[model samples]
Target: MNAKKGNTKLVLLTVAILVLGSVFWVYASFSLLGPKDLGVEYTHEDYVNALEKTGIQIEYEGMTGEELEEYKLNAEKKSIHDYNFEFSDYEQKQFTLTAAESTALLNEIAPGFWWFDDLQVKVLPDGTMEGSSTADIKRLKEDLYSDVADDVPLPLPDSLNIYSKGRVSVVNNQLSGDPENFYLGAVQLPDKYLEEESVNTMEDYFPRIYTVVPGLEITSLTSNSNGEFVFDGVIPQKVSVTKK
Candidate 1:
């Protein structure tokens, strides 16, 4: 009887270990996999079209050595406020940006800005913006844990799937919105994790459209089932980027 009891206990322990291992494997697979494709793709042509629609110009020529250093130094000194937004010369105009165009524009303006790989954005029919990207864990660690002691071991995944949904609008001439949902891999972050300060920082990530074009206001920012965003606002004759 004693021998029979020992054999049964060992079998149960093995089964439990197998179950736990399977669970961990499932969790890790979901966390490491990226979000589903949105079925939209953008090309370099789309980026150029988006820039043209916005009336913005990027004047960058291949500069080598000293020329490149000078350009970087000058860019650092100038701010959005310094840009010439001659409102008086231009009238309000309406324009729309397709989901592809929007995504292309962002990639061009700031590639790897959020340390995301293959970042994409979709404007839902309900006017909410959804974004997905593969987070670069190394870059994230360097940015977030710069002050932490190097000796301390931080156990983090090599990469994570990130997704967020939010409604954004211009309030008092500033970007404003709180994300409705945020997911880090397969885990949905709780409301407590989305602090007010973090929301503010997210809002600040985008440039103030009004500041970019003086007297320009977003009259209506809505989306369609096809994932296109309509922008009813004034557009400048031309937006120039110069070192001055």
Candidate 2:
């Protein structure tokens, strides 16, 4: 190659490397900015407010890293809740829940207003639960708005029976505990309702609840001992970010 050509190629190569490096650096820097740099910063209060809006007092049950550290320095006794690690680790938040809290949370995410005739939760020894709810599909959908009821693919039957129950594990966000186990309620229907299209549409339409929380993935559900629906999945990330 000619001397001038070789020189031109070398300059172009250097510029290309610099451009790529600059682009990569910008991306890396932005990734390191944490939640605060994204514009509006959300405190714990915002999370509480959101929960309150749902008509449930889902309490915040974990201490922040700074509070935890300070408590360790001042306390005379250290229990499970106050244990301090020798090395730094990500702080996990675990919110304890009652049956009412769990029911409210589930209803909040359920499409339309699915009122349960009898909603109950039996807290297990390991913080998991056995939940059962008796829902009268016909009664619940009676007052449903035209637009809201239209979204559901199947027509609202004037009279229908549905019994739903499940065993599940509820966990807190950012915590080292088990991921949330949302067992879809086991569905029971009359034999007459077992026709092909009815079965297909009813099965698909009834169990169609999806979690909208960011960074949460729900796995395929399997039947438990009682042939109830159960899925293993991570709890929703509680950290809320806003763009200012």
Candidate 3:
């Protein structure tokens, strides 16, 4: 090759390396920034409000992370429901529940105005849970376990990382706890479906229930740039209401 051509190629290579390095730095820095941007700003009051708004109270049963396994199995067996769950190492906490207890708890804790479709309610022994309607499962899974195609030029960190958004399944009954970190609940408007008012009620109600669930926290709630509301957060344990 000519000297001039070789020089041109070397300059291009240096530019490419700098560009790639800059991109990586930006992604790493901002990967955890989504929660802050969404305005979740969790506090003690937000937690208290969550339960009151839902007309429910979180009565602690004093369970721990180790106890959660039994409660999980009991819920599966009693409900005649098959489920697969995963949790993050950091997220484990105590909870107490049975299948019947779980269902009752779910009914009690959830807001009356909001109807979850494929409700896969997983309550740990420590009182933590992953509850959502069936309608939201597919998107939930994809968000939790992010995917990317090989060909994309501008690399983007999985926008749906555990810290970014919580998985929601409006249809199926699979709950995962893989990224089980604590966060307070902060419900915001749904981005895409704002025209539909029902979602608005949910946005307004989630924080109220957070109050009584001491072991629980609603970390963050957000919507897409397009305005689709995505709720993501954590509970310390499951809260159940039994037949007196």
Candidate 4:
């Protein structure tokens, strides 16, 4: 009886330790990342620096609604692949980013462009990218237009969800790059496409991300059980540029 009680105590203690560790992990990541200031908070210094580096120094004093959306998209186009701002791989090696870290990085990269109700992006084993996002239709419409009609919020669907599954790979930039330097290439798209005009628009409008670094090659892209995208070959330097 005493042994059983002791075992129970040990199990309880282990669980407690795990719970505390999980909490700390989340806390540390967020704290270390801080508020990367996107969307309405564009005036922040880090934001301004990123904009300046990319030649998008514009005022946001009185902008809102559609105007704000345009500014964000334009900024992303210019800065999505800029150094320090977007691609910060000093070591030219492929690395895996956690869901939280990647989310934070992307939010910083694109800022207020996505007025999403919910969203997620994950690279599974075999280089398959599984992505999902949702938006409140009414809210989106309102955000898109400076003036909204219908006094009572126009009745509409509660939310719209968009999903995408696709294979990804890297290839040497045919236009520019040797075997050593490469660009991220899409080897395949999922058999199941979202088929939503809005989703396609979202994918198209976002700036295309590509890399340009010497002596970086990616033979294969896969992930561990933890879903961390792994690179088979030497992880190239992440100095991506907005080619388009």
For residues 1-244, write the lDDT of model 2, one tens digit per residue. 6999999999999999999988765444322211111122233444344355333221113443355334434433112213221212212223333344444445332212334423444344443435444444444444333335656654533332232222333232221112232222222344444445544454443333332233444443333343223434544333322112
Segments in model 3 whose C-alpha atoms lie over 4 Å from true places: 1-10, 22-36, 59-139, 142-238, 241-244
Off by over 4 Å in 1: 1-32, 59-94, 112-114, 136-159, 194-226, 232-244
- Distance (Å) between predicted and true CA of 197, model 4? 20
Highest TM-score: give the candidate number.
1
**Model 1: per-residue Cα lDDT over 159-230, one tens digit each:** 777788887666445677768998866678788757898687656644432354456666666666676876
The digit string of per-residue lDDT tens for model 4 on 1-244 reads: 9999999999999999999988765444322322222122222344334333333222233454356546665453222222222334433344555544444443544453444423455655554555544544454454443244253243434344444455533433221111111111111223232334533443443212222234445455455668555544453233333333
What TM-score would every model get versus the actual structure?
0.54, 0.29, 0.27, 0.31
Q: Give the CA lDDT, 0 to 100, for residue 220 in model 3.
A: 42
Question: What is candidate 4's CA lDDT for residue 137?
Answer: 45
Model 3, 172-235: lDDT tens per residue? 1122222233222223323443333534443444333233334344344322333223334454
Q: 1 or 2: which has the higher TM-score?
A: 1
Q: Is candidate 2 or candidate 3 better by TM-score?
A: 2
Candidate 1 least-lDDT 10 residues: 76-85
